[model samples]
Target: MPDDTAKPERKRQARGEKRIEELLDAAAEVFAERGYKAAGTNEIARRAGASPGTLYQFFQNKEAIAEALMARYVVRLRAAHGEAFDPAVAELPLEEMLDRIIDPVVAFDRANPGFYALLADPALSPELASAKKPAQKLMFQRLDQILERRAPDLPAEQRTRTAEVAVHLFRGLLPLIMTATEAELPVLVAETKEVLFSYLSPRIDLEATPQHNRRTLTPEEAARKAAHIAMRSNVTTDDVLTAIHEARAEHVRAVENVLDRDHPREDRR
Candidate 1:
């Protein structure tokens, strides 16, 4: 005998996984097109040629399906971002870092515009919104690591804050790119770089300074430094100071948690 039952079981499991993928793909498209509030599980099921029961077998409800789709998208985007940043490529000038990060995202958006649209939608629930922060954090952390390697003299607090700002600034500009005319992309990219450089380049200088000496400032020192800089700058410094405080606090807590071997810090992003 050829173990006919074993073959059937394997085939069924493969088919089930395929069905799940199809459902998720369809859900992403539907949610993007119709907006999350307007889209329904039944529609996703119909698009996937599966029943509501089949969807339930894989996901509890529409929200569960949406969360899974978002998670998958994050994984894909992060992987693509990682692949784009070779050590050779990262060694290029500071300006090129903008292109390295932004180009991958722009390419990803061009290929999967729906995901960007879904991210732009305001109807995303609290859970999905919470999930998104960690993804952003991971991407920023990766960029920070690259920056650290290139600018070894930079302070940890400055590097962390700079990375956080760059990620969010890139994200905020995405909607504009999505809506840009064919002739406008170059202008948009140039202006985005200009704005980012204007703000970030000085911080890089601060980080590269020998006085910084790669010192990891305490949370209070980080906050005070950020506030002092903010007072001297044209922008709001309190926001920067607050972010530095949070990042420092979180880092300390994470290290303590690890040493205590209690609840391991969840590096979701």
Candidate 2:
């Protein structure tokens, strides 16, 4: 109810469960500060202010702690995601809808920085790694469902594609958001909202018109725009082009689809 669907009030009420959460909170901070390869159970226990024996009472090893943290994150994210993607939200103003959705996501990033750390961890076992794919898939499915309702006139393929891009943007933005200073945080968060509004309004905000939805960019300006996007994404420009080249055909087609939909209306004006 506090913008993040039922984060508390269940799954962690008992004394033992509360201790487990305390340990996890410490581990989350540790994992965020140090990569999985560099983190140790002793350090985690120290961070939790528990003896090594106490830590081992609940978790067998560092990997076990990481797995428990991942499992808990999966549950919490699923709950928040369900509310964010609720059909009722589709009736709200576009800005309000974005807030309902984005708030939970930003909260998740701020609270569980370790989730991103473990996501990149090469040492995750097959089970731990496999758990992530389903969660990510669900996120995309829910997002696409909202898009389907909001932009009911758009082609199914286009709607799905838009959801994919939006999810990728969400993933890219979190790392940058996680690094913002307390003073810079609000400004950065507002820019994130602006980015989403601009990307989405042209397609879904039915009140928008071609003349006003987005500004046109010259070829040079578009290149600069792409560079700016890559900067915000926290990825090197060379790395982004390498990824683009790896999926050249698909990337080209995706770009063409976007241009076809958003460019034509401007020309007719």
Candidate 3:
């Protein structure tokens, strides 16, 4: 005999999940386009090709939809943060480490446009803001761990404050980045990472053996100095340095030629 009861229940649950996902995706698009204040649940249902009743079955209102999308984004953000700060890549130069962190975070924000809308929505009440606190807290906790590893000797209180500041600053900047056009985003992102790396790298001890490379440029400093020298040209600091050396060599040869002419080589011989 077929067990009809369980099979129908399973199918119903699967369909429910699919409907929820469709509604959320539609809500994300609508929220991103019109923002939370202007977007309506009916429009979300229309975008999803479902009736208003169907949307109501999954979400009581637009706020409910926003909350659901925020929850989903938080899960994704946590995963991205974990991957960015993976301990396997911890020993990389601070510049590379910051790159890893920034790339994943920017990617996440780009992938979920509605997340920023809801997160930074001016009309959001304190209750809505409270819902996001856990995710923010989780991110800060992960940052604290990263900072602790980078500067193991840093005082616990100081480390906590540093992590909180870093996370808050990043959160504050992300909405602006999200608003930028695609053509302008890379430059903005690059500048942001450069600023962040310059600010944070010196505060932590990242080099494995500092004494071994006393004169060697740390990646952060090297990039900044190189970019300065390169300016608007396709030149690098190494190229500039090489040109200086060649000019010096040519000057030395000219001086030697003048001396030899003034006191002919054969006269000495």
Q: Which structure among the candidates has the greatest TM-score?
A: 3
Question: What lDDT would each prediction earn against the true structure?
Answer: 0.64, 0.67, 0.66
Report the CA-based lDDT of candidate 2 relative to the real structure.
0.67
Per-residue alpha-carbon lDDT of model 3 for 77-115, expressed as tens digits? 888888987865556676688788888878887888887
TM-score of each: 0.69, 0.72, 0.73
lDDT of 2 by residue, 40-141 (tens): 888998888898998998999887898888888888888878877898877777678888888877777677778878864657678777866666677789
Q: Which stretches of candidate 1 lie over 4 Å from their true place?
A: 117-123, 205-269
- Of candidates 3 and 1, the better by lDDT: 3
**Of 1 and 3, the candidate ranking higher by TM-score:** 3
Clashes of each: 1, 0, 0
Candidate 2: misplaced stretches above 4 Å? Answer: 1-18, 120-123, 210-213, 216-235, 238-249, 252-269
Report the number of the highest-lDDT candidate: 2
Q: Candidate 3 lDDT (Cα, whole model)?
A: 0.66
lDDT of 1 by residue, 99-170 (tens): 776677677776666566566565678997776665556667777887787767888887877676555545
lDDT accuracy of residue 258 in candidate 1: 31
lDDT of 2 at 72: 84
